[model samples]
Target: PRVTAFSKQLEKFHVIIDSELAVKMLRDAPSPGKNWSAFLKVDCGNNRAGVWWKDEAGVDLAVLLQNSPNIDFAGVYVHCGNSYHTSSSEEVIQVLDDTIERLMTFVNHVRQRGVTCSTVGIGSTPTCRKPTDRMKSLTELHPGNYAFLDVQQWSLGSCTEEDIACCVATRVIGHYPRRNQMLIDCGFTGLTKQGYGEMASGYGVIRGHPNLKLCKMTQEIGFVESLEGKLDYSLFPVNSLLYILPWHSCATAAMHSVYYVVEGDTVVEEWRPTRGW
Candidate 1:
């Protein structure tokens, strides 16, 4: 197996066991060495991937993983993804506290069973960004989207517009004064069609053009409408360039193969991405 092959070379790696079946699978899969360990994933209300903290079955699985001689039980890990849906700082804090408490309670349960949990990891971009005082018990914080904050981050109150480091440059392609609509060259291909729930208006926000809304889109064309006053055609003349803050940076970046790294007006470098999954 790939894991068995890699374990032979790597110094250490922690496997995530979220269920009883996963524990059995890992136990059945022979290990080449003792360099690998396991992290019992706890579903601290995230409802995604992980064992429910309150489930007796989950705790029993954790104890099973801990008792396994071949695989070391490193600790517990939880991804508080529900924090992303938080609309206010209060909600963010609540999700973070609740998730952390649930994880700790589960950890205490495992520790009482005599398992030495070395790593207590928890993370979610929104929760990490606004962790009021919940960082006391966590040993590791893994916030992936902190690198390139997006409009969704801003909408979730996790960050401000100034915190967003990436934006898609789009060119005005067509104008229809009769319908009070303007078309841009960038659509789902360039600026992904992902939207921030309730907070975002359409596809993305036109940077510095607050009134202009990217209401509709096709493969290569984006329809922009004036949210407030009438759209000033002269202001955004055809061929003019506009920058759009994508709702989700990950989705937008995935659509492109190469990233044009820019610093001010200069094209500093070309960053190429890895091909395929």
Candidate 2:
């Protein structure tokens, strides 16, 4: 296990523990010369991961982590991913409030049992972007995708179109006047087909082209058509570049190995994202 092999190197890092089996794995792991610091991931509302907040087994796991000599129970961590399903900032705030309430209640229950949790946190770009007064009680807020917001975030009212910091720049490869469609170099592999029905503009929002819609995509080709009437080939000639604001920036970014940091028509730097889980 990486934790067992590189315990010293990861002494400062906190691992999230959700189930009793995971706790057992950490306890059974070869002694890393130091106790593993961990946070109990609680499922406040987002049912994706973590132990259910109201489940007694969740509390038992917390207690087990606290009592284990091989592990140190740091606190609680929650991801309010359900907030992303909402359509407005108000709905996001409601999810935020409910998550905080549930998290605090669980923390209180843990505290009643003499388990001291030093950290209480919740995260999700939508909930974090639309903060409520109740969020003040949390010790930490982790909004990971706020760095490169996308159309999904905009649809959830987490941010504005201008706040989307990244896009896929594709070139026109072919023009189909008869079918009223144009082919682009970037497809599902490049931009990802994430926002299917979520956006009116289709897969992604074509920057500066309100009338254009990305109707379909193959592995390496995207079909773009006009939303209004006829396809204008003269406006977008072959080999011309078009920037598309992806629906999910995280998925789109994973398709590329390197990112060019641009500044006012000039590429000032290059960033290579770390690969692997």
Candidate 3:
């Protein structure tokens, strides 16, 4: 309980500090050992959590902890979530390079002030997969999704499309003559229902469903329309199963209680991964 309830137990139940709330807790917290050892979070590039690197507040908070009696400033932490915005190899590389340079600069500056800043941590799946030498100064690497990478990881070149081992198989249910739509049995429930719809291949990009476009979806239906508007799909028989590539693979995985594993002409077994609280 000392470890799992908190995040930075990687250091053996280490009570790692995080957020402005954590920082405040440390300021008033009692010393447990030589010090209440903790890590400081700075918004190096990822704005999701931690103190802002540009806020002056983040740096100041770290400085404050170092001088506090109850807490031992173990080190600093950060993640470059903005790196996820990179749409290409070159852009991903540049974002990684620039992020490391900036974070390390903060660490170097902190040291010049006589504070014993140690752990200079940073992360982002893309940056880690394509590491840069600037990160040699870091104390720890915290990457969450390295275990089972997905489509987003594939698009960023973090992992290949083949490395993505998850998908959904939904069957065609009906063809609408009035709206020129093909209805699939999978809706938000079956296909892990999600999409940016506006994108060329939204509502889960179909692998070989080439001439097809998923226009919209309801709770138990997928509206598959033709992008060309003239191509004939009358050949696809009802009840034909369709394989789907999820928009947010991580989220889609959450909806399934069990996975039906299959091999050619054989039913392997049922595989179930754990889920939400």
Per-model lDDT: 0.85, 0.90, 0.71
lDDT of 2 by residue, 1-277 (tens): 7647766776465689898888998888788888888999999989989989998888888889999878889999999999878867888888999999999888988988889899999889988887778988899988889899998888777778999999889999999988999999998989888989977899999999999999999999999999999988999999999999998999999999999889878889999998768
Candidate 3 ranges with C-alpha deviation above 4 Å: 1-21, 26-37, 54-56, 66-74, 112-118, 143-153, 157-159, 189-198, 229-236, 257-277
| True lDDT of residue 38, candidate 3 | 73
- Give the 10-residue window scoring lowest on summed lDDT in candidate 1: 192-201
Q: Candidate 2: where is the Cα deviation over 4 Å?
A: none
What lDDT tens digits, residue by residue, belong to model 1 across residues 1-277?
8878878887886688787777777777876676358898889998899988988777788788877767778888999999987779889989999998899889888888777888999978998988767688989988878888898889888889998988889899999989999999997888866883433457888889888888988899999999888999999989999999888888888888888888888899998888655
Q: Rank the candidates by lDDT, best first.
A: 2, 1, 3
Candidate 3 is scored at a TM of 0.73
lDDT, candidate 3, 34-105, per-residue tens: 456778776767667676566666667677778877577888877888878888877877877887777777
Clashing pairs in 2: none
C-alpha lDDT of residue 131 in model 2: 75
Backbone clashes under 3 angstroms, per model: 0, 0, 0
Cα-based TM-score, every candidate? 0.88, 0.95, 0.73
Candidate 1's C-alpha lDDT?
0.85
